[model samples]
Target: MAIFEKTPQTKAILDDTEKLVCTIANAQNINKHTEYILRVHRGVSKEDKWNVSHRYRDFAALHGALQAARRDLPLPPKKLLGNMHPSFIAERQIALQNYINEVLKHTILALSLNVRCFLDPSNYPANLTEQALQTVSIALRGEGRYELKGPLPEIGWRIRKHYFMVTDTESHANCLLCWQSYGPDRHLCDKDLQTAFKCLQNLSHPHIDQILAIHNLETGAYVVRKVHETGTLRDMIYGTEYSKSYLSKYGNPKTRKPLTDGQIAHYGLQLLQALKFLHDKGLPHGHIHPGNIAIENQKVLLLDIENTLLGVANVHRPYIREHRKTSSAEAIDVYSFGRTLYEMALAETLEEPYCDIFPCNMSNDLVSVLRLCLSSSSCKHGMPTIESLLRHPLFSRPLVMGNGVHSDGATSLRVPSQLKEEIKMAVAVMEARLKAEQKLVRGAKREVRIQEILGSEEEMRKQKRRAKKRESVWKSTSSLAETVRSQSVSTASSPTPPHHTSDAPACTNGSSSTSASSAPLASPVAAGGTQQTKVTNEAPATNGRSALLSAICSFDKTRLSRINSE
Candidate 1:
């Protein structure tokens, strides 16, 4: 009986598998400064949570490191003053949260070593490269068959996986050495792992590259394979730049050199033959992609066939788990092969798995093969087997080698009866595990879809509320403008009253009389039917009063004199 127990490292791997959700939960004041406590939640469960405290300087350091790859980071600006204040700290905390969220949102930045270490130091240590090197060195020291060359840095996309160049001591031929964590899903015990490695070492086919050596370690395993200087098929189609980051490698398709129709037909047929051979021996190359294919002397050599036994997560696991139809181990391989073919045909990556419409320029026969593997109808019913694909019209003709050798004449692969039985059992176990994982993934996807719908509806509601508020504000402003406009119109249209001095005594007569000079002031108003009161005030004054006031006094004197004469 085999026994398996989930360790802390296994739990950590499981936690890492979940989508990361980071938030600055709160800010704490310590040592006369503020430190933000970031609550990192990996999954929906509250139990899968951890907190990391960081200062503004820490965020700045992360920003500086990432600025080269990502220019538009939302890092908060540094504050020279009042940074320690509560309000400033709070605002900075939110800004930092947004910055980290933005970083995590991008796949490239999130996978970068700097960002990973910053978010989870315990999981992604700064000396991760050194540690991997040391582990491989120790393993190689024990097995003196291969000489370890210097480390190959950032060569592949998998973060946990490390690569190193080595030379086979016996053959004196250079080979590639790779080490990756056993992962959380590995159920095989040490004994089974050893047996599996031995089976893989003995396994061989014309189109499949041979595994020189494989060793299972405590935390992970390392595999050695012959290194082709031409690099992977991806490098051949899309030019290689090993120095560039993994994300940048696929960033530019303009530099791609697409294969001709003949080349596709030839290599694709060989790939199918290799897959068929594996199936015949009761094995599945669970991992298949352009990155795992290499070509030398016009022969298509499939690499990384041992990944399945190593128990590392498949590159297309996310896509595979999403569709229930792709639950079987063979179906998964077919789906992956379809994707690889799509890339080869188009010289462009298929961003999504399902593609209904293909370019008109592509060959009809090629598209037909693709449809068999990738069409929704095919996925619903069943993807064609590798043997059937080998019989397809596109690959119906025999592939002739450069040296006048026909590929169809290659000898069939043979495996020991005991080894074959063991492989069959292993494949069964893998299929069962994959089906269980698919179930879990489907449920998780359904929940995610629900949350997205709710979030979208909430966002719509918020937008409507904001629009209503703006409409109300606009209406109030328009009404206030109209009131001011009407007041000005009423003030301009009305007639002005005759000028009077409150300090002057009341007229003796029943009606008060105005002086002649006051007539000029009223004349302009009477002619234009507009107020000139403001214009009259601008006129030069006599003594402390205007000319109109002096005229009023003169008229009053004249009126009194006239009364005396009467």
Candidate 2:
């Protein structure tokens, strides 16, 4: 009555799981126009790949064609206005991409579309067909030029849509039991499953249900997820027959509702953290209703991320309609989350004209946060960022694992003791590593400064040697000039008496006049020599002090820079 018996179908399902492969390789804008080129790869084989470009109008036309082709099928809503805006166009492109993704994900849609167009690209419009063929031709030419080729990589967890149920194993662990049903359309379930798979990846949290594995059968696909035993928040508030009745244990005496101020805070924190994680990754979980939320063991888990605008292939949903139709995807998620907080606080599903329901038993802090979330204004003013929401005073209270009011009189999230401890331990380890890194950086700076000092000392020594060589050359040149001046003065002053008596007197007079003029020149030469002597004596000391001071100043400045940087 519990676990399913191992059968031939089970093995076949597991084997086929390996064969199912689908990946989105690239989404390129075509010709700088409203169209986008999509590269879809199926399985690991080269033959399974195909490329196609689709514009916004093209997607609308495809939807219209599908509707005309089948009156029974439900199509997602189409944009009637604001298509010209860049942001709107980008979001619509993603929606179209997700729609195509969903089409390929389901067997019925895949077969229908395959017959309609995908089987042969030429079946599309002439321009689109030409574009596809040209893309193929370009790829073929590139492949031919390659001297070698090998098999391509496998696609991502090749998951198709399937129906699933939560069941407890003998080990007391909860497992998601999924199987394909050919009964009804079940496209909505497939939509949810694909939304979960495609939107969030490599994300983990106690409050988040993570995809564990996928099993594909000849008839349908199966998805397995890690979950808690306590069931979902919906099951807790209401009741479930699958496990020990949570209602009997945790429900209130009067209202029979287990969720109170403490429980709301706990769930709110976890849900906010999950939302923050998604928003940080640029993913908005368009669907945040109560049923999509699960409570595993004691932790509140956020389920179904794939229902984002693009995740559902544009399927119309009540939650999307309830929230204002805005171009801001993140804002839509925020408003939905606010609505969820309002419901959690009230312990009931919120209906139209949702008024402020702050009961006397509810804490004021919790009520305030809910008010901010439920505000009708724009996100910038009414809704704070996810980061700011996590910091609300409600979470400031000491968190106790598995419920009960905190010592600070505030009810806070206490999903698990182990998770909180792990986070604290991680923080401690990071802090220690950061300190060690800072110390290493300081030491490296010190080493660099010491090297600079040594380099500056060597430079100062070179300056001193050059200064000494210049001073010696100046002294030798001054000495040679002084000796030549003395010899010239002595030759000019001599008598030269034995010529003619008349010429001798004239020569003596000319010699006397020349000596007089030379005497005045000698005074300037003496003054120049005195100035040169003074400069020669003081220049070395002055130049050396200035050079040494400059070197020291530069070295100190470099050392200071290193210190400041460290």
Candidate 3:
């Protein structure tokens, strides 16, 4: 039996920890080169597994493109000699596998269009933009109300989401057309999704961008909204130089213009009012960022309000998952608003390890509001409500300039009774789904941390074992040296035998006794020679023991140094 049941309709949502895992399952020689068959899956599920084949050149090309972002990529060096040898090919395959694994480990590289297309060409085709344009064109033609002008290439961050410029025939007004896949995370079924879109089309508020038309399809949906010539709020702040590239737009926030205190207050208050209006109707935007907002004549308009119903993941999901208090829909909106505010204030994305400290130059009121929304205490307890944020002193101050003033005073949305209940039910279902997903994410993160701790502990135990082995070697060497020293000392302390036979030799006559006295002297000299020989032999043994001791000491020192360095 499998650990996980296979449900083709239910697609799994991958977290950061469960990144794309690839293995070179096999290799085959084609023409003059070797192509490796890679088995790829986001998680340990047979249903998610897919295979892709690529030659060495493909890997090299991928590395070349991504090298600028990550300089120290572990791409294996190309071999000229014996390149087609089976042994070499096998080794290179392993190296290439590791290189790709390293590449996918990085979130930026993993999410890159190049890498995605390389790994799964079937899904992320090279002509993905063209395919999106075609699908959108067909959908718009079927509706007969809008005419597709041209695609807005590389405009947004989402891979499956595409944007195009379109014109409404009846009004002849230029509008923005967005086509996005329902995706695996979509919370509503087809009927409910249609109802949700219908409800959104009728929504009217001073701060909300009105949806001109909505066409939900089997695979995805197409939405049309009036184009803002000023582009998104992000374009307003970042100068729109790299707006076509999602990475460049977000990766270089510091190089852009930050919102001033007055602008922040003006925009912040309107955003809060918009959120409050939605929350009052039991709806949440779910996606709130600079890019999802538009500025027209100094007034902020919240776009993509139907994204929550679309069941797409939130932009700040990774950050939101870390805080349990953000599980609720309203709280999630508040947290997202806080992040958006941080970016506007500092002209930089709020990085992890969120802090409460703010620049001294910032106003006290601004800092207080930031802390209330972003501080660790706020995450643990709960962020302020959108209504409360509207009442905040930072936003409550009277405007010197008449900014964000709109004639549309109507704050309520009216829909069919059935559609209203459907919208309410959809919002409730989406919120429950978001909360469940967040719980899973938190659990996964906790498990990862626990694994890291266990790995460190295991490494410590190995280090201790190595230290003990070195200590034992040192003890043994010291004992051997001591034994050798003791042997030398005993040999030196024993007294030499006295020449007692000399008295008998002296009593004998001169010539005959002289020969006998010489013989006794020879015996004593032989005894002293034997003692010298013993000492000489012991000296070499002592030298050998000293050498062994020195070698062991050197080895121990080297081992200790290596261990300390590690």
Against the unseen true structure, what C-alpha lDDT does each candidate score?
Answer: 0.74, 0.46, 0.73
Candidate 1's displacement at residue 177, Å, is 1.6
- What does candidate 3 score in Cα RMSD to the true structure? 14.3
Which portions of model 1 miss their true places by more than 4 Å?
1-18, 24-34, 43-47, 56-109, 241-254, 375-381, 397-422, 448-566
Model 2 agreement with the true structure over 1-566: per-residue lDDT tens digits: 11442222311111111112233333445565466666654423346556666665665665664442232333346666765567876666566667766555533334332223542354323242233233333443443421112211111111222222333333454455333222111122333333334334445555566755433232344344654456556555655422332222222212325466676777777777677766555445655756568875456668755333112311212222223322244444555666676666665544442335566776788777766666444322434667887788876556623363111322223223443343334334433432343354456567779999999999999999999999999999889999999999988996553222232222222234343333333433334345444544567775644543232222211112122535
Please report the candidate that would top TM-score against the real structure.
Answer: 3
lDDT of 2: 0.46
RMSD each, Å: 11.7, 25.6, 14.3
lDDT of 1 by residue, 1-566 (tens): 14463322542244233456789999988998788899887644547679999888988899887765535788878889888888888788878888888888765566667777887888888887888899999999999999987888676767778889898889898888988876655555577667777877877677888888889888788989877787889888878754355655653434778888778888888788888878776668888889899888888889988777666677766556556678777898899899889888878777554767888988998899889888877766777888788778888754433442236544445556766665666667767866776677668778889999999999999999999999999999999999999999988986575655577545444434554334434544345422334444666554335544433333333222222535
User: Candidate 2: minimum summed lDDT over ten consecutive residues — where?
Assistant: 148-157
Instruction: List TM-scores for all candidates, in order.
Output: 0.70, 0.34, 0.74
Residue 483, candidate 3: how far off, in angstroms?
3.9
